[model samples]
Target chain A: MKLGVSLYSFAGDLQTGALTVDDALRYCAALGCEGVELIGEQHIPNWPNTKISDLDHINDLCKELGLEIFCFSYYMNALSHYDRRATMEEHLEMVRLGAATASYLGTRIMRPAFYGVPVENMIEMIKAGLPIAEKYEIIWGVELHAPFPPVYYIDALEKINSPWFRLIPDFSCWQTAGAAGHFQANDVETLRPLLKWTVHCHGKGHVFDEHGEEPNTPYKDLMNILKEYGYEGAVVAESEGWITNYKPTLDVVKTHFKLLEKYGR
Target chain B: MSVELRIPTGGSYALTEQFRELGERVAFPDLNLHKVEMDGMKGYEFKLRNPWYTEFPVSCAEDMEVGINGYAVQKGKIFFVIRDQAVPFKYAKNLYELQWGLGEVAQVRMLDGQLQAVVKEANDVEIKFLLRTAFEGYHLPNNRIEYEFKRNMGVI
Candidate 1:
């Protein structure tokens, strides 16, 4: 699988002026990652409304750094601030827009999260986004998150069975030794079935210990699963440092990427 | 602790009155939800549904970001929407009775390096009532033309 760093991993760095847009790109290159994912709203200049000139700048920066733009992450909601149909329609539009944005960002994959969204609503979103995905040359999918599992979407994925409808498993699904730190440990067994449908992995990492490793989740078992499955996709590190202070969150991210390379196969 | 609101574009969106107040009160940074069609949603609306909290271990996760879209600011004032108020869910209570029913004052307590807000689990529908009224109190700055109805309602 290809190794990458999610701009999300360095959210702290971005907010603290420790890294600029170009700086983030260069950091990933320096770390020897093959690709990068932009949270889109955060790192991209004029996010949610970026100018072509800005996209050009980002494209050029990635080119100079020898990194491929792997994925773009965005958000989707199912709550009806209005009526149900209105909410569903709005979300569907977001899928299309997110896909178009991913195409502009030079990636074919766009990740969206639909917290509390019913599976039915997501299915509708997939159907609505297919045409746009085909038009934009992008694939729109949901990230497998907690409180919700990829399994819940199994029927939906099977029903749709399209490349545009897939899962982006964040290592969040497995119990790294740190399952307690985030959410409860998911049955790693539950994740096996979703592998064939997974186009990318969030490759999440938490606080590290004195041993210079994440103590929360078991990386070896998680990596072995991906490797054994014959999976070969981007393992984009989505680091969340458990330390409160300005700990080098990027270090944890780099470590996660290296671990994936070592075992993610 | 820092909080970030990640409002998505490709639709109309506005901040909740209470959330806007909190943002202003706390001086949270502002971001433009750019290239958006101001006409995405014709009027301001709020969802009574609660946020899905069980999706992730938010306690140990990084900063929280709320996404919004296709909602337009009606008349210069953002339309107020009710978010999950951490209260027990109920239905059918009128706003006035619900307002009078508000209870459970909260204080943020830090336990194990996490910010925890302890509030009494609201019984009945008062939480929604209190939340709905926050909209009664807000008006976007320099957007008086839209909030004129509030002045007529003696809401000021």
Candidate 2:
């Protein structure tokens, strides 16, 4: 399992122009991250407006840093009621555009959220997007948010009807929901079976208690599950704030990396 | 356009049912709820607050756009509580295909159809309520909300 960070954690820096995409990648490289999850809006300037050639420049930079591109994160709510087809078209085009860009970046996974409408509409919307995903030979990895029912996640994936399309499970959300006894995130044993289908993962980090270390991810247990199943996707640190105190977060991830390295088959 | 409101938990079936009711109330001839079963449910247990407070559109933009000039087409608004679940992307796909963007300006309006210019606090309230509700509904402990949206009610 390769480790990485989503650019979202650096959103404040991006807006302030304090960090460039290059700078972010450099930081990741410095952290010994094997990859970086590129949130287009954060790392790619002129984003939806960015040209294909511009992205190639980024791909080249990643190669130079020895950093693999994990996925292009585009967390959007597709269900806001809009007045014009032009705007809706623009949003769809953005995804289609990202698909092309992801292809160029040597990864075909487009990470998105299933938000806004109810689950049925979410499924319909996802189904409608198949053409775009298929057109670009890209997989649609819906990041599972906590309020969304697990049934909806499964339903939508099955409906999308593509091996390329799957769920990018946010273990935190799962844990949160299960903490209430509403669902269960602890069943890593069950998830282990579906390892082959997992394109990537969002290793969201958080503090369970004040004294607990940053990114108190149940890493060892998760890694054990992945190891048992021979799952080989990047367990990207798709989180925020864990690295604000860069050293500690880096230590946490690096330690996890070592653990994965030790157990990784 | 006409609008009707209902309250249901945050899931697809509830929203589709509400939409169907709204479409029927407005006399739309054809409306379809695409069917599919999604796996790896993540946030199913999050409780909904006042789940009865769902809205259905009463008008179509095609009609309003012709008469209103900046006067822009009034994309109908629906107000509901959303917990800090995964960001919903499928909603956009459905709306795009169905031809509705989150209004023109992404403004936040109240349940009574009044725009709340200073919606940042109110937006946070929605999120908090949803999270609390989800926790109670699911019986989960220690899932604090980490992010939220307070931007315009319109879509970008």
* Candidate 2 Cα deviation (angstroms), residue A207: 3.2
Q: Compose the digit string of candidate 1's lDDT tens values, residues A160-221.
A: 88887788877665644335333356666776888889888887776656654556666777
Q: How would you encode candidate 2's per-residue C-alpha lDDT over A1-265 as one tens digit per residue? A: 5666665555434433345667767877887778878865456644545667778888888999999888887544332333322245645765677788778788768885435334566676677676887888888787754444333466555556678677776655445432321233434454554455577877655432333322345655766776666666777654443322222333444444344344443
**CA-based DockQ, model 2:** 0.03
lDDT of 1 at A203: 72
Best by DockQ: 1
For each candidate, report its DockQ versus the true two-chain complex.
0.03, 0.03
Question: In model 2, where do residues sit more than 4 Å from their true spots?
Answer: A77-91, A149-151, A176-187, A193-196, A208-216, A242-265, B1-156
Q: Which parts of model 1 are misplaced by more than 4 Å? A: A77-86, A176-183, A242-246, B1-156
Model 1 chain A weakest lDDT span, ten residues long:
A77-86
- Tell me the tens digit of each residue's lDDT in model 1 across B61-154: 1111121221111222322212222221222111211211111112111111110121112211011112221111112221111110000000
